[model samples]
Target: MSDSLDSLLATADVADRRDEVVTGVREHAGRIARELALLQGGDYGSRDFDTDSGTWTVKYEGGALQYLRYDGGREEVYVVSAHSPPDPEALAEALRDYAAFVEAYNAYVESLEGVLDDVDTDFPAVASTESVAAERDRVLDRIRAVSGEMAGQLHRAEGTDYGTFSARVDGTRWELKRERDQVSYLRVGGEGGIYLLSQYGNPPATDVRELVGSVPAFVEAFNERVADLDAGLSRVEL
Candidate 1:
């Protein structure tokens, strides 16, 4: 071949080689983007496209990137396009970064698996807390206060005629009765804390109690109130 023709052929070969390099890197970038897209999960109108060059998927979107560009505080990952004449070394570094990022994210997800598994499978777990116990105690207090007050008031009001009382409040059904020298009372239904509130004058000063659940605080309060009332009753001339 003539010198000029040979030179033209060589130049064409060089252009083709340059095109290959650019095309190869872009295709690689597209593959990386595709992997990222899969990792992203939820559909942001993501779709993989294939052409003669290769397959590639959008990251966010060209428009989204444009909007993010002007936002001073916004930070995002960007990739060099093969069309932009990507440097081979830069592309390799980017691939390494993507691999590391994927690995790191996968590790984070694996770490969370134990928590998720517990959440999904572990049932009847010990969810009770001190706060819960306190709340239960409060409910018990309500039962005690209401039953005691009603029992006391009825006993005083009956003035020897106080025989029996039955009432319901906030889903708690209660009954109070007097037997000879004893006052008996009961309340049921409030946060699973009530069984029976029957009482009989066992000791000379106060009534006996048969109740449910362990709420020492409320029991103390109720016992104090009833004991005081009984003491006052002992003093009255009537």
Candidate 2:
């Protein structure tokens, strides 16, 4: 397997291990909270505390060692996790950081839930209207350009040897083509109408005009269909 695939597998393994460690830490913390409540004579919710500050410590030989401390002024309990043996100071800091993070995360989640509820209640109709309008405008503009090109091709021809045409008609392109006694013209009419006219005999101008005249009704019909399609699309939901 590629190195990237190997790295992805390794990342998955690390994530699983991390989750296991975190779960063990949480369970250990919960036990500490229950014990603290029993000892301190109150129901105390546990937050992770910093061990480095002389507040908490742990000793983990097999899985995880957990510790807890009390903040008397705040009336809060803190849990500390030690995956391996750590000095008192390190344990104290880790536990303190964890507690702070948990508090912040809880507040953020509450605020987000409130915002989501408000959006669900108040925004669906307005969002749908705006979405449909924007989509209609975009599709209409595209169809307009396409129809215009097809209309213009009714007046021109296309070829590579006679150089190139830079003008756009409706949404189609017109170009001229020439080969010996014959001249070919191409009119590109968006996704639907594509026409090629090749005339032989003398200057080929008469044949080209005849070809264009013969297709006048067809070209007009195509333009009408394109307009109808654009109108239909404008009425779409989104």
Per-candidate Cα lDDT values, in order, are: 0.45, 0.43
**lDDT score, residue 117, model 2?**
56
Q: Could you give candidate 1's per-residue lDDT for residues 1-238 as a string of tens digits? A: 6887767544566556656754554565455454444555542434333333223234444312111001112222234432344334443434444434444435644665557454655567687466655655555456556656655665665566457654454334444555432455453443343444444311211112233333343444545656777898899995
lDDT of 2 by residue, 1-238 (tens): 6887767544566556555655665675555455445433555333333332233332222222344343333334433343433334433445455555445434544555555454555545434455555554454344334434653443333222233222344444444333422334344443333434323212233333343443444445555755776798789995
Clashes of 1: 1
Best by lDDT: 1
Model 2 is weakest, by summed lDDT over 10 consecutive residues, at 198-207
Q: For each candidate, how many residue pairs have backbone atoms clashing (under 3 Å)? A: 1, 29
lDDT of 2 at 46: 34
TM-scores for the candidates: 0.23, 0.22
- The residue pairs that clash in candidate 1, if any, are 185-197
Deviation of model 2 at 209, angstroms: 30
